[model samples]
Target: MRAHHLAAAVLVAALWGFNFVAIDVGLDSLPPLLFVALRFVLAALPVAVLAPVYGPPAPWRYIAAIGLSMGFLQFGVLFVGMDVGVPGGLASLVLQTQAFFTAIFGFLVFGERPRPRQIAGMAVAFTGIALLGLDLESIAATALGLTLVVAAAAGWAVSNLLMKAARPRNTLHLMCWISLIAPVPLLALSAAVDGPAAMATALRGVTLETLGILVYVALFTTLVGFGIWAYLLRVYTAATVAPFSLLVPVFGMSFSALLLDEPFTALKLAAAVLVIVGLALNIGLVPGRIVPQRSART
Candidate 1:
């Protein structure tokens, strides 16, 4: 990768890394599912209006699958989990488990085999995750938060595979359209679960901070970060681009501790290291490169 693109990759990681805290802040004012619904709405509206869909319209079923799984369900659960207690730092680490799940899904669905190293990495990472599950710190680290985030991670893996299977000619465009599609169902879900009163309170309570977070997430993290990432993928091999993503958890942990005052426990540290190592081994596999087709999740 060119130095410029490498720098852009790092920037994307940072934007996404700190985004967990943004979710936490926004959820203070917004209900979880409602927050997610608004997020996708804000993310998609301008793009939907300004940009044409990435390719010919995708299959409705495929579009719905991506919209619901990736945009609504994954984020819906994630915001709820984080708001309940999942520390932003640890949440970032746990979500990276998507790397393992993605490989698993690819194997099961596409018959694509994970390299032996990746298998080993998955085992190591899961072992660390098990340690995390034994967490005595708080509910955030416990099943309440952990399970939901893990579910989100698994959803993300499925979303990526759907993209692969659909094989859209222009994935970036499909992503924009999926963003548009994902939010509506979530709005309906939020109205049912969060209740009309909760939604009313959230809207009434919206402050500058909440709006800032919403805009930051919609524009910076989802749009700008991904725009640069997609550009890098088009220009470079995945191997050249993917490992820099390991830095996301680093920034996430730092921002969580510094910004949110979350703990940096021994077990969490160990888990982070193990997960990073596992992801490194899995991502930077044989042949020293992955073709651009296997894009990293933003």
Candidate 2:
């Protein structure tokens, strides 16, 4: 990759990494489900104006499924996990487990055999997650939070399979369409779970900071990040652009420690090393046969 392209890839990773902090900030003001509903609502706005430029890449059913799985299920569970007890940095690391889940699903669904390294990588990464579970000193991290985040990772893995099957030509267009599909169900769920009164209150009491966080996540993180990512994928091979995503957790943990005062225990540091090493192995950075590589999504 060229210097500028490398910078752009790193920029996307930074935006996505800081997004966990943004979500953690937003959750202080709004309920989790409601925050997600509002996010999708704002994110879908571009689809209305840019409908001519970015057409739907798949059938409505496929788009809807992607929306529900990727947009709603993954994010909904993620926000709730963060809101409940998961620290932003820890959540980011745990979410990388999605790659392993994706590999597992690929094997089961498409009969794509996992290489030996992939299996070993999965073992190493899950061991890191197990270590994370044992770390009791990490601030605000809980068993329920860890489980929900892992489930969210599985949801993300499901969306990856759906994306592969759909074979969308334009990722940004598909993202926009899915943005449209996610808000309705999210809003309904917000009303159901968060309560209609809380939803009303949250909207009525929205602060500038909260709105800024929403805009950052919707416009910068989701749209701009993916837009640049799609461009990089077009210009370079997936293998070339994909590895930079491993930097996300690096940024995530650093930002959380600096901004959110999230302390990294010895166990947490060891776990981070294991997970990143496993991810490196899984993505073919450490050698072995390369399979169909998937780009990391936030």
Off by over 4 Å in 2: 287-298
Score each candidate by Cα lDDT: 0.81, 0.88
lDDT of 1 by residue, 138-180 (tens): 4246678888888889988989988877776566666677888
RMSD after CA superposition, every candidate: 3.6, 3.5
User: After superposition, which runs of candidate 1 have C-alpha atoms over 4 Å from their true positions?
Assistant: 50-57, 138-140, 285-298
Question: What is the per-residue lDDT of model 2 for residues 61-117, given as tens digits with 9 covering 90 to 100?
Answer: 899999999767699999998888899998988999899999999999999999999
> Residue 191 of model 1: what lDDT?
85
